[model samples]
Target: EDQVTQSPEALRLQEGESSSLNCSYTVSGLRGLFWYRQDPGKGPEFLFTLYSAGEEKEKERLKATLTKKESFLHITAPKPEDSATYLCAVRGSYNTDKLIFGTGTRLQVFP
Candidate 1:
């Protein structure tokens, strides 16, 4: 079976606090790793895609980096507006491009 896991199911941070979220997986033929931010009751917004190990991407207050077995999302001095659930997914095969998603990390930034 495909496997995806995220650590620290939930996190609470004061405004301007920085932290990192982790996503780990064990899958065969990893095609890509994707990161997304999902607000309450809303669909996930795509953040970055890491196609291979050693690849990294950044935007605004967020940076995503990938390794052979896991990935990390780094938040740099996030604001209250950054509070959301962060999702990690991996596409394992080329047949259909299906994504197996982790449970997601819940982040709350307080003002």
Candidate 2:
């Protein structure tokens, strides 16, 4: 079965701390994998989309990368404003219209 799993269900970090969030998946064929940042009481905000292994995307303090079976979201010197739940979703070739999403890693950055 195709599935996505994220580790460290929650993360607490001091301002300017750096860390990496993991997203692993097992699918028949990968079409695209996505990253999103969602704040409380709001919809997810798109971050990146990686289509194949070795692909990467970056925006400000966030960098996302993809491998053959997993993806990673790296936070660099995060600020309090970066606190949010980081979500990972995938689109498999078997079901192009559907997306499988992980439970997400809730990140809290404190000063």
Candidate 3:
């Protein structure tokens, strides 16, 4: 059974603070891992796609890295505007359009 799990259901950070979110998965023949950000009432905004282990992508204060069994979203000096729900999803080689998603980690960056 393929599944994705995200840790620390929620996180709260002060402005300028940095942290990382974790996403772990178990699947047969991994294909790709994706990251997304979602606000309170909107759909998830695509962030990154990692195809293999040791792959990484970055945008502004966020950096995403992938390993054989897990992925991490690293935030550097986040601001209040960075507060949102971070989501992680993965696609297995068995399915082209199917994606297993985690429950997400709600992040709050306060000033």
Candidate 4:
């Protein structure tokens, strides 16, 4: 059973508070790990794609790293605009193009 789960369903942080979000996954023959940031009522914006363990990708205030069984999204000095739903997806070798998504962790950065 391939699955993805995100922790801390919702997070509220002050403007500069930094934190890490977790994405735990269980998949057979892992293909890729994807991170996306989504705003309310819109599609997810692509963040990173991790292909193997020890892979790390970054953009602006967010950094994502991957391992065999889990992935982490670390936010550094987040801002109000950085607030959104962070999603994790895993692609299996048997499943192409489609990514199985976690429910997502909603983050709110209050100024």
Best by lDDT: 3
25-80 in candidate 3: lDDT tens per residue? 99887888999999999999999999989999999999999999999999999999
Tens-place lDDT digits, model 1, residues 1-111: 778999889999998889999999888878889999999999999999998899999999999999989999999999999999999999866576789999999999999
Native-vs-model 2 lDDT?
0.93
Candidate 4 structure lDDT:
0.93
Q: Which stretches of candidate 3 lie over 4 Å from their true place?
A: none
How are the candidates ranked when ordered by TM-score, highest leading? Answer: 3, 2, 4, 1
Q: Where's the lowest-lDDT run of ten residues in candidate 3? A: 91-100
Off by over 4 Å in 1: none
Q: Pairs clashing in candidate 4?
A: none
Model 1 worst lDDT run, 10 consecutive residues: 90-99
lDDT of 4 by residue, 23-99 (tens): 99998888899999999999999889999899899898999998888999999999999989999999955857778
Q: Where does model 2 exceed 4 Å of error?
A: none
- Model 2: ten consecutive residues of lowest lDDT: 90-99
Q: Whose TM-score is greatest here?
A: 3
User: Which residue pairs of candidate 1 clash?
Assistant: none
Candidate 2 local lDDT, 1-111, one digit each (tens) = 779999879999999989999999988878889899999999999989999899999999999999998999999999999999999998865846799999999999999
